[model samples]
Target chain A: MMMFTKPHPAQTIRSSDAVFEVKDLGVAYGRDAASVQVVNDVSLSVGRGEALGVVGESGCGKSQTMLAALGLLPRGGRITSGQVLLEGRNLVDLSPREMRAVRGSGIALISQDALTSLNPAMTIGTQMAEPMIHYGGMSRSAARTRCIELLDLVGIPGAATRLASYPHELSGGMRQRALIAMAISANPKVLIADEPTTALDVTTQSQILRLIDSLRKELGMALILITHDLGVVAGVADRVAVLYAGRVVETAETETLFASPRHPYTKALLDTISQLEDEVSERLNPIPGLPPDPRNPVQGCPFNPRCDYVRDVCRAELPALADSVEGGRHPVRCHVDPFVGLSLTMASGGAR
Target chain B: MSAPAIQLKDVSVRFPIRKGILRRVAGEVHAVDSVSFDIAEGETVGLVGESGSGKSTTGRALIGLAPLAGGTVECFGRDLRALRQAHGALPRMSQIVFQDPYASLNPRMTIGETLKEVLEVHELAKGHDADQRVGRLLDDVGLRRDLAERYPHALSGGQRQRVAIARALAIEPKFIVLDEVVSALDVSIQGQIVNLLQDLQQDRGLTYLFITHDLSIVRHVSHSIVVMYGGQIMEKGPRKSIFSAPLHPYTSALLSAVPVPNPRIERMRPRIDVRSEPPDPSAPLPGCRFQKSCLFATEICRTSRPQLRSMTGRDPDHLAACHHMQEPHVREALSRAAQGAVS
Candidate 1:
């Protein structure tokens, strides 16, 4: 919290310094009549050992953007325009054979549900070992040894015996740990955890958060944590980017973002969290309307319909993602300055 | 206390396990064991616990969905079984809104049809009267009158939930068991549903048994909270007492583990390490169900189950099931936590 926001906006971070960078990313799904532009002009960068948190509701393109980077998007989905750079190499232009090499070695993804992600028939060891042997080119016996070590690294107790257990046989917590171990086996430079704790209990969730944080620190890997729960990101993220509809609404250092949010959506979002001070009868000051449908192209600002601070300019013209103030590095996209209303809401003892 | 809106005395719900082939009774799983509480009229009581903790079972048992092995349930001063069997307006007094709106609602039926069906089943209204009643229910839940014409598939997740609430309301239920009604929706939408519920409660003087695993939302809507672990009650009290000065070790751990939205506060609070697996039902623990992972467990905790009791004279309304509250060391732990908060 003591760390101040950077004085300059995110000024075209070079791929040499950033472990992963997505530039002017755009993704769309479906054919002719059913086509939907799910992601539009989205851009972000993750420096080595940095943690970038992407916060958004469903259908906000949080997952699609990362999936585009990994070439894991479902059928009918295409990266219409973008550059996914890893170590200054463009991933979008890579052949399937080349992209396969980049996946396990350069970048890894931990999806939301571990049960569906794991192979039900395969033992945890076999599933884990296959990845290491195929990617790391280790022998079967050596890969087995590495599997146990990876399981132990993830904080799973009795790692050796647990290796033989199937996914269903293990608890949800243990299954998630195994999944994380598999993701990190090749020691990828960038780790993307998409709603990693959503399926677990609070106690299990806490343990997973701690484990992921310590692993990032120990291994010096860049991390991208995608979640709807702002609290999860607040604990571990170095920087935060809030997405709305299909655009970046706010981006800033974690401390600055929490202290002085400039976007109305961001401010309303901060208050949506239930705190100890909330009265039983008092309603949480939620953002007014649902997120815009992706099937239809939004005009001007996508959030104008739901934003409390909307004005004529907000509905007529799109806001540029520029510095909120003259010298501040915190970038916000909104035609109207949302601070006046945010301060009023804050004075009522919300967003503590 | 003008006879609580609903009362449960020594309530226990169990399920018998059967063996393979012969289908003989093996043993029983005490889903909800010796749980007892009262929900006063027009008050919201939150029931929170992890999966398999019997929180959901407790809610189901109240509505007769889960059979009570041994206990007595009284609703509006009438026996629950008798009231359910009488089948007049008695069945309309209690209704449940489930978690998954997509699955709970009929896909083929329009929102209007769903609400109208409930009204017809209860004989609350008919023909034009039913149509007008359905329209009013939609308005009460904050949905547009036009939305009633749409199918369940056409509505958004939040809108579908509102229709489900409207269906529950069409029967004119005085008591509702909201079993994770808002957990599946987005954060912004969750607030909308919660507000609608609060508004409906205000208008109808409805009593609710809100069950979920999310502690923050529970604190937001519940006047009082009940914490369950395994099959027994860990803590039960007014919201402030349970959130601020929880006496039970399980309650403290559960609350402490929830990630706070603020980075400074969340990062600062010391965590209660509870990575151990939840208790096994097949081999029930001899004493406290939470003893395996409890930080203050001693020999007595492993020998005898601690009953829910008020720890201090400051507030008798708050109750916790823990043996260490009598010890000076427990107060020391509380002081240390306070010191941690200051820094």
Candidate 2:
């Protein structure tokens, strides 16, 4: 209903200054007719020291988009179209060996599960030093010294002794910190954290988020944080992108998105979550149905069935993502303007 | 008023920590220690805590799944142990739905078979009658009766959770231990399950022990709350009082750590400095279990364990285990922290 006119600090960065950008990225699985477009027409960018949050449910292809950018898609999964540009270099065109060289020092990833990510047999020191040695061309002794310093920077206590311990010996929080330290070992220009704190406790989750936020600032690295939790993104992300059915449904500055979400799906998502600051209501207004199965694709807008303000056009034609208001930075993919013709009664009522 | 539906008094649960090749009884790990609470009929008591805080253990102890080392668990004013000894099993009045619906449901069996097995085991119904009852159970949880013929792998996570809830309800239990039931579902689906749980509670007059680490969900569901840490009850009170003005430092810290979905409020909120990790369960400290992580810990907290006591200005039932809960400075600090004011 309203918009914040003030420009955010992250918004001031020009596109030329973007350290990492994914332009109209499309990823698919399987071959020909059997192929399922898991991510389609998705574009995102993060400037130096900026954090862009990609929020979506489990099957929305949030993870697959980043995996494509990393050139680590699973077997049978391939980039269908578009470019993954890291500092004006099109990573999609790079060869396997070249991509490997660009991975650690150019852009690094911190995945959700730390236990499985790190090698069990290898000591923490070994895993941390291997990346530094391979990417930075450092000697073994020097890499070991840097490993301890990185561990200390990520707030692991007794860092020197911890280097000798295995992954299983460390707690969940410590293991995550170790993974983060290793990710930033080569000081990449971009960092991608996918559901980094989903497995952790509330207290430990806060600590991890703070650590990641501070590291992004201190290193001046672009951050692409992918998660399903809005509260997590609210704390760390400067910009927020809401994804649905493998497409970007809405994108805006973090404050603007939360203050006044333009898309029907984004509005519904915000309503479904029970925030700590919100008054506990009698009943939650949950979106009535489940997300569409990607294999069995839906026609027109994928969210049309569940959307409260569904129109005939929404079911007939897919809406391209465009700026909602003239001269407004917020882009929404929807057939109808949610605020237009919205009655107070309809707004208060639950979805049909 | 009427005897509480479930009562736990000074309950303690311990598991042996065997050592060496001989499997000697080296020591014990107190999984639950001296925890006490009451759940009135048709009331929900939220058990909130970090992982390994013994919330699930407390739930298991109530249903006779875990062996109690000390104290008593009573159901409907009768001792649970006595009931178990007389009946050869705990009565069919209580049930539990675990966190992982996928793991809990059997993959080999169809959904129909799963519901039928529960009915047959309890001798609640027979062949034709079981089929009819199974349909109703699915309908009760808002699932299609045709879904009964499908296997667990075919159904979605939310649908599988509904099947799990249906199996729990087939026994016609008046009390259920929902251990992180909605934690596995997406945020939108979580609301659906929570609303379903609330609706079922009203229709059947069910009493629930809703255990979870998510604070907002707990705040929505529970009439009262219990905060546990390191196998001990840190605080217990009406939900309003606990959230509005928490007296225990651990409770305050736990609440503050929960991220608000709004960016403006989240950034302005003052977070209490919670030091290090949770306590080691094997070697719990002598005094306060939360002393190591608490910022306001003093010498008294190091030597003497503070028992749950009600403060002067709060509700009589509102209790906290903190030595300095009544002191002016500590109370002010905790209240300020709970109110999200910069101090």
Candidate 3:
């Protein structure tokens, strides 16, 4: 079930061919003593033309990890430590002035909620051109031409006329496309789309995903798709990273990760969502308890509270993201083997 | 045989499309167009659609929340609209649970106070007996009795949802409308809430009109499924048939659009791209409403609207509103199934 026949340490991939990489990244909110580090030592990379997905529940720090890399964290949110390297250039130490240069041209972000992400007062054309004029150093007329071309590229009909229309004038799908069009206006090397289609309809969702997939192919841009939906990640992502309480719990190629999850959290996440393919069971195997509060310091594994396969080791030592087998590159931070949880889950017959 | 717990017949919800400073009715907006379905006693009828497909409106109209322009809603052998008109208010036979647990619950009231208010308003329980019953309801939804003291903001999303369920259960309603109830929670928490609902349904023998955009949960919790598009019922059938074999093009497209969590299977599966924009509710196209997006749509489909007809030979409960029921796509799917069976 290996999608890419790949087994490289995420670091090796990051240090080597990665177009964008985040190493030992940490993010905190509030002051020093009272501050809570929500994102802790999270590392990830996306090879040029590769789609890497960061998936987790809310407050898992998946979004913060990416926002830190792009320097778009909310006010009061600070990058506590670590480096966000793009093509070997450290982005962490870059000043706000220098970071602004890299914001749209070096790396672009398509955030969730297109309605709010876009400026309500600006026309679609003006927003699309601002990125090009600022990052691409293009003249207003040239950027206007480029905007029209991008709108056409993103499959918006009557591209020239629609550019004059405001975001509110377009449908939900059209607004999302306009957002994507705006993000790629400067032709950045990396595109980070966070829950791009969560607000869209199922049919429209597939269209948006397909559009992103096609754009990645055509532009050869490194893609980081962040979402909580495993099904969405399974469709478009080359590799999958499962996050829990500000740390990576599992990282592997999509097919391998989905087929044989090593972490109990990953396995529970897989079993929790009811699939159309799966026969309707009497009850789903829900992992008990909520995600660990990021504000509270955790002892050992953060998932130990909810994990069915938790052992003494899970409670005593915080498992580092490490190779699971003698030669396996699939990294998993778990105290128990996959079978321990799988067999137990099966034996319990959907026991809570 | 017992009567169906909730039955909606030729239900159409329309709002006047107003314009200008005069606030005149220019045209009518068909929110729900002649949608019909029945929920058997202790049965679940999943009503699924995208945004603006009228699933929520249908659920609202069932409980007399959304004004129905036409058609009748009968709850346990009573005309719900007429009963509400005559009595000034219909008794709590049907209750609804909205998606946003935060907004649904009163922020000022504690969980205990909320449930107690429901009991008092409905005259189900009072005083010390009310507290005991509220505790039992809390237990039914898998929440601790002590949690009743906490306000909605103090509790987690899942806990607050369970309290909402307990509040609905407080009325002891025969029918419950779950409108995107689990859409706001996490995946793991969604599973927990679904299990609680299933357990509650079994224990209380309550009827459910489950409405949501998420099809997987619908398939999991529902005994029967109704696929709605463009404010119309495109397909309705037993869960087994609808999932295994779909007749309408829109139903098939909707099903295929959902990405499977299994990457290997998802990569190999065929996807039908519905390129057309979402159908406008204000101005629904003539003939087949899905014709704009349906790949198999032809001149015939564009010229004539199809009636919901039963599958004579297949499961008699299966019904699809499409002109080309005997199209080649079904045959091709069948042949593929045959090939699959042989291997």
Candidate 4:
């Protein structure tokens, strides 16, 4: 019986200090009658110099949660209910003009598709300098200098020479580095990277991960790394949050989460990699069934339909995240404890 | 070879690069540089490499999508060149599944019509029979029958890909070249589509030339793996042999860099550093193409070319192209840098 209550605030590793605190956040698109909730009752925090990996399948509300926090959800999307506290001030309470002021100055986002996210017609220098100009209120020459420094900081060689190059001219790895440099140019306290390395090859992916890891330490910046790659989370993230159907089903430290994942959905995701490694020819032990339509909402656990060990109570009442394994350090939202059948152990030293 | 489904013997695809107003041929970019491999019947051969490695070109050449400037492409004992001469083209044998599903499928046509087009082109079916077969093909690819009436825009990414797979099956082809088919899909959906492909391969006895940059999926699906670098085969062997005991430095680097889900292993594993940028195809290397970036390169390595050959004391299927592959020093270097981050 692992205790799964919210731990004392001090128990969390204050890598730098708390930078953002989100509580009972909900995001909806459009007005009341036309509203559609994309992210629901999600709560998360990013401590200074901490890398929190928010991982889930696509459309699992990881991106939407961060988007709500940043006030950047598309035209129709709005924060219906939530407390987004940045430096003890409520960001949701701010006016649009004030929120705009807080955006790049406080939080920056690196979108998944670098090609589309980046302005194609603009030179890398121009795009990189835009943040400094608007947020830092620097002159063109000063901003250009800062842009060159940023390009160099992110490991782009010959930054001065390459500043003239457009997004298309740079390679994928280079483009990502440039994007990271741009994101950090404003010296934002919180950085949200959505599938940052999904497009990169293995070799480049590791490089980018290392770069982000090192930069987080250097700048003492808090990070929310949203991705589908569990591999990326295992090595880098200090805290792990697993999302499914607009709800976070589990949260824990990286080591504890991997060693003893408590949620069935988490276990299934872990098993997927294990199966891949074991070279089993049979169909993957995937949680069968499509995600519930957001429009046609369901009651109780959203994953109940796909979970193998579903119970009657699980279908009728949503399980509150209770104490699980990891010495009562984390919480899990599942009917059965995940460790019952799993021979749970962290993979020992070798190629991962 | 027990009648290989497809074989490329010293095949090359070169495009003449023109410069200036006169458009004079300045040089030829050897996109596929005398690459050779074979896909046996009902066998899936995975071609893995970074961009510009010519994996896609090799796949395209097998299906006659790219013109071969040199060497031979023979399918089931029939020379494609001779067939082209006799029939003025090759058709309905090798179908390709491109990476981007949306770009591959016709936006205007419904899924039913897309499959119909494939059948009409190959003259496989017509009338009510054609309609019935189209629905069956969709079902074969794990897509719904109602999906046939929906346009590409209406379907999910995975559904559109199923439509592509359905169209590929419409020809009833023996060989299918899946070129990065699932790279664009979500990870969870990726597994579903990959499983579907594996099921289809087994049921139809299809031979696959699976081209992808994703080594993880390649390892799972391909029976044999070919690692390409700078348009040449760096290494090629049976999946187990190649994965567990890679001989080439390039292959060794590639396999180690693939991030496993387990954190401890990931942290402990050394990251192999391959070159950041792809090689310039137009510029011919003095010796081996990888020699410039390879840490093991010596004076001899830079002066002489290495042919793909088996390392002594290894299985004959395992082949690598490196002059120093059999040397103890080279092996030590490969193992030392094998798990390091991508170069």
Candidate 5:
């Protein structure tokens, strides 16, 4: 069910060869005196038209990692090490102006908080057209026409008329659509949508998801959908990367990840989703205690304190990503074995 | 007959929208329009709808927070209007939990102070007894007894919400109004709170008016259900009956919109086409509130509002407000809509 843009023909693959290839990236705020590391040695890649999902609880450094990749981290924060390669270009070494060119033209980002991200006074049309004019070098008239087309593509009706409407005039759903349109206006090779449909209603969320799915397919852009909702990820993502305390504990094909979750943390997250109010009111299988505070970082496994099947080795050393039981394409970071804690026992034949 | 815990007989809530400083009555927004339902003792009835569906208004009216413009709200056989006129007790038997936990709880008050205030107002606990009761209530809602000294800002969203629940339970109310209680929480935390509420209801035999837009949660917690649209009850029945075989198009449409976690089911399901946002409550309509968007709506639907009526003998309590409920073609259309929803 998890599909990429390349799988679908007739789509313009923005960069059919390569989209993003990030390696050992790290972000740190302040210098040696008052320094704090937010994002560690993180490495990930997004294929052309592939949707990579980043999931974790709050303060897990999911946002900081992507911000570092985009070179959009806040005032105090800066990438301390590693390179972010987008379509063969290493953006880590780029200057401020060059990074700005790569941001909207090569890769675009849509933040979760639309209210603050959007210009309150500007009309939807003008905001949507800004990228086209600045990045695509389009004329005023051409950009306006493209903006309307982009809005229409995202399922907004009366796009021509609504062009004059301010951000406040549009509903929450409409504002999100306008944001997505602006993100894709430059035909960027990669689109990073951080919790795009988090606050929307179920129906509106579905619509926005479908719109994102269609845009990724049609534009052939690699999509990085950052969210905590497994249901959202289940519907759209091609691959999933589970982050914990600035480190990716697991990464795999969406189906393999959902089917036989290898890491204890991944298993807990999946178990939590099934416990959602689908039929009966079930007690929460809470991952007890808070995520490890970044201020005082842990020495061993980041998830050890909260992980249920922790072993002696788990407390002493960090588990590297290795082949899971199913032998999927990706490796899981765990030592105690996911199925032993899951009680699969081999005879149960894994989950349905 | 079992005494109904809470009953609304043709209940209506109308808020007047003003034009400006001139104070001209622009129009009366029909927040809850002639809605009627009954919740039996020890039963949970979910009132579900979209943002502007008046579900929250209905919940507010039950707890005496919002004024009822017309009809009657009978709580445990006593009419709320009659109680309002007498101006005594102030419905001590009912309490409400608002959507925003931060806004709902007093910022300045500590957890201990807030719960003590509730107990003091009801005169249910005093001195050492009051302190003991506060600790017990906090523990009941999954909060530590030692955390009572902390202010609201010191707590997380889930913890603050638990405090709100503890305060609602402080008065020992028989009925509680939960308005989108878990909507702001993380999914894992939501599951915990939901389970806690269910356990509380079972243990205390408390009646709950669970108002929310989450159909899945409603389907899980509700005993009986009422789907509201444009201030009217579009459908009402037992939870299983309504969710399994919804008669109204709006109910089916709303349920179909929730994304299933299973990839196979999601791929098999068809997308429901619910065009146009919810209508403005201030804009008065003569006929059906959903006529403009309902595909099966006819000319008669646009002329007169349909009264809530029974359409099947299977469940006398199951009712819907649609003229074509008995029509085979309409049934076919609904089935197709459901198919489209899953496809």
Candidate 6:
């Protein structure tokens, strides 16, 4: 509770300054023994004009964590524990009606698939204007004019004509831009974009990421970018939290995390990707096994099975997310400090 | 030198756009337009492009899945059309693995049954011999032999993809078309699959048409790269030349757009301003397909389509289609825009 109230003494930006925060949040599906804990003991905070990238693969609880925060978990899903705070208010305990009010006006989400997320039946103008009229108390004509402006802000050319067009009328990139425009219509303090560019081409993906970054700074909103691609996060996020099997394995500044990742899972994930500048190697160093099943619930460190440097202790007991250097902002959830007493190249599974 | 494994000459694939209950042809969507390429024996040709760029359609045309509107496809100097006309069936020498393994696989069939079905249809093996081959195919793809009994639903996405690859290999093909095979898998699993594919290609001496939108992966696997846009070939060259010194503006734009994993380089990189979506294929445009988004587009570019001509000062195989590629200013502008993109 004290961790929630006061800012960390070691950190520059405190939790008190955070526009949105999730403290030790846990989410589960089903009931009793059969229940599956998809997200466990997750703590994250984002301040005004700051972007936090939550990086993880499929079934790593990246989407579940955000869904729990928004009070938008599908049927049978429940927030098992912890608090999601928007400014001063606890969102986990909010009523259904109150949560509805907070959605577009307080925190908005832009999902991965724009086609499905959008209402195919409604015109793009109607969808964009509805939130403005309902939440901002604007007239129909005023809302219509504002929709065009919002569309133009997201780099949609001929915004006025696009408004009257249906969702099917626009291309994939255009539909995504419309979705982003609608999400920011209420000018929420926090924006959660879950895999916004996963379905897009590289060209369109860059454009969307740049737009989101600029908008976050312009509106001074806290941005949570949830994606599986490390490359996408590298450009946008100020800080990153690497997740594995529903737990935060490592957290650090974006540059530090990429330059000197501490955890074995984090290092392995970095090595797996084929970088644009990388000289073609004969083989890629892939993590040995698949991600652990959430339903089965592995003991100790969830990534032990797949970790190249896993020890006996790793399989027996769970490790705390603690900083290797005292008072440092970088925290890693691994018992073995691979970098200790080793050169950076030697520690990174050199020539293996 | 031995003949090329696969040769495509002015290949075009068109799907009719129909209207009304009678389904009259309103127009034609040219999915693949005059796409020509040659894959040398045991070489991997990476066909890269965004959606609706005809990369996938071209892959399908090679395997006889997509009917060709014009031109000839020859495998090992044998005309595919002539072979199919004489035998009443397309040769089984070529195979393809689709992107979504789950959709491509049957829900009711076990992995063993799926592999066995391909053998049975091809008349390659049967009975206990077929069962043994099924296990070997599963092993070849790095899947456990026990997994042959499990259904596709029971397997993970990576495992299902491996099974799909196993089925493709069941026919013992000389050529394979992998259409975004690793696009659906996780990054960690994608590496495993990519490595597996490389190993298989070396072992079997397989000629591969690796079609994907990911530039990084294509650079890793391909000997030569083919850049496509709006269902037309924009550039074709050795992978290193294409990466190091791209002659086409569209190719430079694509190379710039790929986000590097390194934060420092990513932040410093200058993105080429190819901001608009790809040209609509259904409504064919006159002149260069990329003219609308091209940074160096001129009046001539809007009036005449450029042909894929060899670059004078570069590798003989390095070819690009652009009216101003030979001009020093255009080359300097492209290099300036993409200077910070990669290194």
- Scored by lDDT, the top model is 2
Give a tens-digit lDDT track for model 1, residues A33-141. 8878899889888999999999999889899999999998898999989899897889999898999999978999999999999999999999999877876889999
Candidate with maximal TM-score:
6
Please tell me which model should have the higher DockQ, number 4 or number 5. 4
lDDT by residue for model 3 over A126-169, one digit each (tens)?
Answer: 98888678767899999888888999999999999998999888
Each candidate: what lDDT? Answer: 0.85, 0.90, 0.85, 0.82, 0.82, 0.89
**Model 6: per-residue Cα lDDT over B91-141, one tens digit each:** 779999999998999999999999999999889999999999998998899
Off by over 4 Å in 4: A1-17, A280-283, A324-328, A338-352, B18-26, B336-343
For residue A54, what is the lDDT in candidate 4? 95
Error of 4 at A212 (Å): 1.0
Q: Write candidate 5's Cα lDDT for B22-119 as tens digits.
A: 99998899999999999999889999987778999999998788898999999999989899889854768899998789999899999999999989
- Per-residue lDDT of A201-318 in model 5, one digit per residue for the tens? 6767888888898899998999999887777887898889988888888888887677667777777776666655455544556666567778788878989998888788888998
Off by over 4 Å in 5: A1-18, A28-38, A131-139, A277-290, A296-299, A324-328, A338-351, B120-129, B327-343
Q: Which stretches of candidate 3 lie over 4 Å from their true place?
A: A1-14, A274-281, A324-328, A338-352, B123-133, B333-343
What's the DockQ of model 5?
0.44
B330 Cα displacement, candidate 2 (Å):
2.0
Candidate 6 wrongly placed segments (more than 4 Å): A1-13, A274-281, A338-352
Give a tens-digit lDDT track for model 4, residues B144-200. Answer: 798888899988788888888888888888899999998887676777888888988
TM-score per model over all chains: 0.94, 0.95, 0.93, 0.93, 0.90, 0.96
Error of 6 at A142 (Å): 2.0
Ten residues in a row with the worst lDDT in model 1 chain A? A6-15
Q: After superposition, how far is residue A74 of candidate 2 from its true place, in Å?
A: 1.0
